[model samples]
Target: MKTSLYNIFSWIRFTFLFVAVLMIWALRTLNWIWMRPNRLEKCLRKQGLNGNSYRLTIGVTKESAMIIKEAASKPITFSHDISARVLPSVHNAIKRYGKNCFMWIGTAPRIHITDPTLAKDVFSKYDDFQKYYKTNNPLVKLFIGGVISYEGKKWAKHRSIMNPAFHLDRLKHMLPAFHSSCSDMIRKWEKMVPEMESFELDVWPQFEALTADVISRTAFGSSYGQGTNIFELLKEQSHLTLQAMDSAIYIPGSRFLPTKWNKRMKEIHEQVQASIRSMVNARVEEMMDGGETNEDLLGVLLRYNLKETQQNGVGMTVDDVIAESKLFYFAGQETTSGLLTWTMIVLSKHHEWQDRAREEIFQVFGDRKPDYEGLSRLKIVTMIINEVLRLYPPVVELTRIVREETKLGELTIPAGVSIMVPTILIHNDHEIWGEDACEFNPERFSEGVSKATKGQVTFFPFGWGPRICIAQNFALLEVKMALALILPRFCFDLSPSYAHAPYVVITLQPQFGAHLTIHKIKH
Candidate 1:
């Protein structure tokens, strides 16, 4: 009877302890989702910032999605003013709450910053305002994570090692690969065009192919065939990622659930990593056996990595190499292809600019293959490319998060509030770009990007400050080469079937297609 009474007492004690722990967990979660957000909202209000009232766990995300969906349902008429259609929710928010406002992206408040000064502050102080993880969805990292995702010392180390690969001398060595890819693409286009007449075709996919091929050749060199396979997988992965994001707001730990999107994303990531890992291993083996290092991106990176390891006793691992290489493929293909696509569309609209660009191209190259020296000399072509970038930047906006309280000019930004620097909005700002900000005037960039922005942080198509896109020069060179080759070969104008719809999937791309009639030049 004594033993039975002791056992009952122990069981009762254990039950109470379990319930106490459960209640504590529930209270903390409630504080995180409710109490903390309300506190942040009140704090922002005290500072005179305006925004919609926070709504439960979803916040304004659902409302924003609905607006975006409604805006994307139909294409706006042909005009350079695309800010509304592209970012309807943000645009609406700005209109309603003015510039000095914040919006809830889930529980976190994302403050819109149009002021160039504050944008500069956020960008320059990379450590304070870190790279924003767009969503809490852990699976999103599978597609977008890489060197760009790292912060502080890790970012510095990766940047230092990769810097040599994009040096002017190294880029010049990759010129042959660029020319070869462009030539192949042009040859295919010529085949598509009839002997002495015009043939209508979609140039969007053509540019995508051209850029993909260029990246493959420049990045992988002799192993370009395999690189092509990786590019395709990445393309599909991007689409799946967008779908997953559009489907729902991420619940923490939901990535582990056996969902279809989750499964496919994991599978694609594994495949890409496996393919890249195999290539990296092969190259490392070659180096270990005292084989000569090729000047391709992978080879150059490995060479530098080895040097770093030998000197500092540590370097990037195979996984690190894989991540960087994956970045090269995605960034290289997307940025250039988007630029080239928009260039063609813009040039077609402004025939006079096209004539002048062709005149300049002829003056520089004149029925010969474009050399780097000749490419640099084509000033008119450079201006046109710059104008296109301003009007249709590959990336629409940049987001950064502050982990701790940070001061930006007069405002004191609390920890966990995100900063939204809308690149598209800044690029088209009347105050910054003048009255003709929305117009496609290449003449504005005649004195170069620095002169055009008047030494402000306004024009950052490739981004701004230290953490700018590393391959901006590489992308620009490729564009110059492509435009040089195509201008002397054909005259292009938009086909009647074409629709003027530009939307962002991964980058700003045509909603319909870039259907243009290509008239083969009779030389």
Candidate 2:
């Protein structure tokens, strides 16, 4: 009787285990098949959005891929407007389906938010609407880490740690770094010119090098000299990341798959991390060896990190330091370069405004180097930069993913939806900026950005609300220094080869080049 009972119990256990496994598999299949699409469609209907009825499993992935492929194949043109090439598809969808519309890209439902009030709501509730796109592209993930990718407590902690580095006093101390970088650029340009005579050259690369130099000097101090080549490697890594995005949908563990591109990406990611790790280790050691705490950004950040570690005994790890350092390198370099390049392009086109800017620079400094105090006095120069940012924002679009069901304005945004706030569209909107919205006008920002947007959330070059860019002051200061040096030393005109194609590769950048004819200023 005992043997028979034990045999029956053993059989029961095996049967139960088999049933559980089958149930789990069924649920996973259902999630992929029915649940995801149903949720997406219901959310859109509730939000009063209209779009192509989502087809089975794949949804609109096939159509979206075709559009992206076409955009990629188009020949590069300097005169063609970037928005003109890409906005039609988006605009047509909105026109057909109304303002709050949904379009599928893979399994994701991209909800377009064009209304200023809706945008304001999305920007303000950033914690709820957070960045959620995860990819198999390793380099992209590493470079864009930190507060930009983080949400909730992680974001708050990182932001708190980084805030002190960009303080007003701290920026003032770093003015020399900016000056030194700009001075290097001017010297390079002077040598390129034939006996300092008029010549046409692409200014995009110059702006890039200047910003790279600034980030290197300010971020790593002596370490930048050692890590200069690594900066170039990081730039290459950025390009590879963009290429990786063009591939088909990536599943979990996709990077481990036996594809040549995947292997190359993995290698690059490893190399970048290795380089950053070495620099971070060296800096930590130098700080430990009785080195004076300098006021540069990296120095301040390291000192703060050390203090936090000592006090809490559970502070940021070496990996965290490396991640933040990469963030500083990419974000610091890209933003300043974009701002300076666009500002230069706009100032070149609008010669009268350029003259006013040069006049402001002359009146404020008079051929002398612009100090932090003197840069502040150049009101017209500041206005020109602000106007350029409004027209060609460094980040053309800001995205946030909804993790849980939330009400944005009157619409209920369901979980796993992407809210896209196109900064360029709003900035160039006729209703918002009047009839001459697209025109390059500095006077629009003369009274300040508040009046420029007509009290709406229209002008958000550095973003808006609680999650607004932390490095706005840092970027502005760098721009002020570069403009102060360039406007007084050289006059520039848009070259015939200059292209107006502004494409988004992490940041909005000239697709071809920013060609300009430069003539030395006569004293």
Candidate 3:
């Protein structure tokens, strides 16, 4: 009996050992096949592109994180030129390496292209350099979770169906929502102030609230209170997502671990998705039941998508609608809020420009609500807004993925490479914008975008190419509308408490709140 038991134990041990060896071999083989960087890095190196040679697994990710964290820790002097502070890692890499270089994020090589001509190609050619997952950050993909994830025919269809919602005529309909939301915010500011005297207030939260309010009212015909809650949830999700990127290192299946952050992130996303889904389904049902057709984004999308389906036998699904609505919340809210915030701060500093804008606002509308034509005619105001966008763009950077081995310019970009299309870096490039690139000058955009770039296709505060922001008109209108109300009603200057540290938490924004001293205009 003892001899028989011993034989069985030996066989069991041998079987377990065999299975472990097989599993290890399979994992290593998969890693080598999918995550190895020898061939592409070698090609990039041969082409004279500089940067750290590719390392296994983490691959300069840890070093890059250290560079970023260190940069953030040591704040710079009060200045608008935040290219270094905003993108220190990239800046450092550019210094250490040449202009055209490559870094690694896991096994993926990030080919940093700073040349404007090549950068232009990156944006114009959608297929060769496409946007898959941003920097291979799964958390970003999880939060973005929108049509941006799609490619080829699907992407075209998605863009097609959603285009009508942001059309010129459609945006005209949203003006009332914008006006009403901004009015409520200013009214509260009026109440907060002691009759015409100046008072300090952090306009950051106010702008945040205002944008959320406008998105709520315009997107779903919901009140500020309701939209505030949903926007807040999304805001939290984005914060957590960016934090996860900072805290967690790149690894296979790292996000799925049952860590506290992972769990909380998953839960928050679930809640956001659920809330958006409910809104989408209700709107779709209302459309089907022939109820009052809401003209807000949700309603228009339903109607527009219905037509698309009827015409081409294809349209955004219920989930597709949901993703878009969330995108509307994310991009629409974040972009407008940041734009307005930085505009207010810059206008505060450039008090001369602030006065000029008010003069233009009153000259155009004279205390009346701004119409689209009138707003369009406010050149000074538009210049100031454009300058603010150039100085402090909402989105600091855009990126694309090299899906297949592709040739852009002189270099052959290999598959499994990522591209960085930095908006701020290019916007502030002295070479492109001349000596006063870093200065706050609104005259650059006076003649229009084409004339501003001298027909180079630069000044893409709203991005460039076919994938240019659909909400550009909408956002510009909102800023025009918001500033028109605020400027004529009150004059503001940067508060003593306000810090000028611009940072990036997904979008370029003032790290500290934008506190300002507001003085009412005596009639």
Candidate 4:
């Protein structure tokens, strides 16, 4: 009996020892992955590029997190030269390692490509340098999780199916929706300033709501009033997401824990997906019933997707359609809002240019509804929008990763390394844009981007190459329509309470809120 007990104890001991050995091996493997410099990173260094050394798993994440927190704690003085404030980590890296340097975003060694030629190459070779699996936050996939997230044949198929929806004719058909939404906002403003003189209000949230309203109508065939619940939920989700991503607040594995925020984020995502599914299901039923339906974005997308499935036996699944709809809700609204806000803020600062824009608007539309032709003719407005996009773009950066060893220019980028196309930095570079690059000068874009860059591929606010934003034309048209109507109705100036602190969450925004004093324009 004693011998039997001893044998059993020995077996238990053996099992524990084996487990310990396995754990140590797994840890060593993980450490290797976390700290080992890839061939691409080595190659980059050999080619004279510089960066921070790789550390286990975290890399420069802790350092960047601390720096970003510190920067966000205090607002910089009123100015647009906010590269330092907006991306403290990137700015510090540039200051330390020069403009051409690498930085670590988690495990990925992100080479900062400031050269326009290199930038162009990165965008052009979309297949070679694939987008990182957007599950960066996991739930972020719900919002920007459509065609922008696809690659190879999947991307080709999705883009082909959705192209007709945003074609000039389709977008032009949606102009009345844009006008109606813009007019609704104008009416609200008219009521606020009932005396018909002037009023001081924070136009930031106003524009946010206005853009959200426009997107709701165009994207879902529902007005802002009708889609208020979805928009509210989205707003909540976004705030929660930003809070979760906050460098100062983030904790690994916390998202998996039953924390309030994690639970809430999951709940919101579920609700959003369910809402989208219901909308799509109802639309599909109506289409199946042969009932005429409003030709909004969802309607167009469904129609095309169904036609494809019937003809070719391949098309977007219901979930896929839901993803595209959610993408439209977020991207369609977020960017145009930023554009309008910054344009107004800048125009308010440069009253003369505002007058010029107003004069141009009058010259083209002249107390009439803005048509596509008139919007196209507003060269000055276009220039201002481009300059704003340069100075304060919606997305501050773009990133691509080398999944396998690939030669770009003189260097071979090894797999597992990501590269950053610092759009804001490239846009603000004096080397690319001359001495006045940082200055807000719409005149630089007078002859357009090609002429402005002297035929070099420099200005890429909507991005460059085939992977450029699909919704850019749609966003710009909405901006022009809203601005054309608003410019004639009111002339605004920055309120004394206005503090220009441009910061980035997901997109560039006026940190202090865009407070503008509005003066009703007299006929």
Estimate the lDDT of model 4: 0.83
Per-residue lDDT of candidate 3, residues 318-353 (tens digit): 888888899989888888899999999888889899
What lDDT does the true structure give each of the candidates?
Answer: 0.88, 0.78, 0.83, 0.83
**TM-scores of the candidates in the order shown:** 0.97, 0.90, 0.93, 0.93
- Candidate 1, 1-523: lDDT as tens digits: 9999999999999999999999999999888789999999999899888998988877478778888888888867778889898877778788899875888887778899989999999899999999986677878788886678999998998999999999988899888888988898899989986777999989889898888888877887753466778888898898887766654367778899998888989999999999888888999999999999978888999999999999999989889999999999998898999899899988888899999999999998787788889999989999999888999999888889999999988888999999999888888888889999999999999998889989889989988989999999999999999999998888889888878888888778888889998889888
Which candidate, 1 or 3, would have the higher lDDT against the true structure? 1
Cα lDDT tens digits for candidate 2, 256-318: 678886666667668878987887887788899988876677678788888877887655678
How many residue pairs in model 4 have overlapping backbones?
1
Whole-model lDDT, candidate 3?
A: 0.83
Task: Provide the RMSD of all predictions against the true structure, rounded to 1 decimal.
Answer: 1.5, 3.2, 3.1, 2.6
| Local accuracy of candidate 4 as per-residue lDDT tens digits, 69-97 | 78877767766677888888888898899
By summed lDDT, the worst window of 10 consecutive residues in model 4 runs over: 243-252
396: Cα error in model 2, Å: 1.3
Candidate 2, residue 392: CA error in Å? 1.0
Q: How close is candidate 4 to the true structure, as a TM-score?
A: 0.93
Ranking by TM-score: 1, 4, 3, 2
